[model samples]
Target: MSSEQRVLHTPDPAERENLATFLSRALRLDQAAVVRLRKRGSSLVSAWVATGFETLAVRTITAELGVDDVTVGADTVLAGLRTGHPVDLGYSMDSAWRGALPPMDGFAHVDDVPARALVELAERGADLAREHGGVHGPPASLLDQSVLTVTGADDLEVQVPMRVVFALTAMDFIPHAGEKAEARRIQPTELVRVRATRTWLRLDARYGSVARRLGGGIPLSPS
Candidate 1:
């Protein structure tokens, strides 16, 4: 993953017109509407399809020199193009679809191994929380001057220290015993806010410890 952000360049009139025609047909629009095309990096293109009224639909289309490729991402981007309603293009669905994270700052790619590992860890965490009657803390946290080293297959590693916010919930109970009282009463819970500078993610290699516990066989050997 490169630290430098990808740039988007405005498409020329011919390019825009071609994309508009394609989008109009794909989206089943009655009128041939004008569309906006922005060059993403070197190969990917982002198209803003007009709804012909007030709003516009934005999607990332896989193209090389304004020529659309017959790929899953390109087809998905075309199919996803709509009118009137808003769609949230949260993260890139695959490598071919390079949807920009809005306000666009930087780019990072997560391969299958890491993605599966993360998912497995999450499931294990949830299971532990449910069985132990406790809540799991946030998986990732932002640190002012701290970095998290993520190691992947082939000894690939990166230090990501970006700012992020996460929420966590916890439950606690007070134990009380009285000769006159047969049952304990539940008390109202209060919220407490605290500030911290650092966070940690623990990992182990045991088959039923974390990742393997989820039955995904994601080899996440965190140290």
Candidate 2:
């Protein structure tokens, strides 16, 4: 890591808040989580973290990272974002990241599911999880269960797992019911995109994205 790369600046001054919120949320999910910041083009950077359900949560914000990529403790980055200073991100944890990122393109938009519907599904799943959860939390069967299936043009079909919905709501990607809003949490027309590559299934929510590989982190691709 170079001195210049340690510096973080939002493309539009307000984006720092979004980046900080992202890191903080990721940190809460995994206390020891490391954040992967990959610079995209000259104006955007994508920050990703494993959401502990074998899915990756990603948020892209405008920024200048000075380097193409770097990994740092999400907690540290959160603090840096809050303090508005050049943070000592410490050592690069590029090696700590253990999986492949999905292709930037090549995803076919299989279908669109109403955000409100998915939120309802997540609520029901949460209730079930609490009723059946043990020392390890929700059972793999429940989380892995396919809750919805979409078949689009060309006979394309995608089965969305409960885990994707869980990850989305857990990250506050789509505001939940109890969460108050001037209007509805998600508008009736607001939809979460369900896209797929041969190897990945992606859910693009308003705030961020939750991806499970057709099958892993980003379980939802075959590893």
Candidate 3:
């Protein structure tokens, strides 16, 4: 809980750059955003941010953070990384995260959808938003509509909102049409995994994951 900026280390340049990209996306979504860093174990740290669309985004990377959990300003960490400044994450915003982190375990495997499918859905959502949105952006009905529903074992079904898809693309979680020709040429048939608990629904993409409240009991099954 130090007011002073704290330092950490990520020796691998690739991982550091990836983290930088995630933080930058978060800042772009909400300029006053904060990133919560939670050590997953001895090797990886989960960096989480609240996507402005009622969802949470996380990108876990390997690093030596020396601590278990802390929250800091996204812009501060991004600046430190850009300037080679020892990842001096400034001003512990421990209280900034106002919601509970999803449980690391116990999520039921609901289904898997193609990454390309998700990318396409996001694109269509954007077009619809642009056509109908105004000063306040897309209408709540569009954002909250159940655009997709996947059924799973034990009679489980969940509806995915356009806002979730928007958050996914906004965070650059899934690969899409804008990749370089070289990257597009080798785009793998990666799948976006869907999982859920009684309280939340999560979509895991190539780069990160986005989750939001289910607004009802999951599974729609008997207890």
Please provide, for model 1 over 1-223, each residue's C-alpha lDDT reduced to its tens digit, 9 standing for 90 to 100: 1212222222444443444345544345423333334556776675543332111234454443232221222233333333312222222323432222222222222122222223333344445435654243323222121223555445544433211100010001111144211122211222111111112221211110111111111123321
Better of 1 and 2 by TM-score: 2
lDDT by residue for model 2 (102-154), tens: 87789999988899888889889988999999999999999999999988899
Candidate 2 runs further than 4 Å off: 86-88, 175-184, 216-223
Best by TM-score: 2
Better of 2 and 3 by TM-score: 2
The TM-score of predicted model 1 comes to 0.22
Cα deviation at 132, candidate 3, in Å, is: 2.0
**lDDT of every model, 2 decimals:** 0.29, 0.82, 0.81
Best by lDDT: 2
Error of 1 at 46 (Å): 4.8
Model 1 RMSD, rounded to 1 decimal? 20.2
| Model 1 weakest lDDT span, ten residues long | 164-173
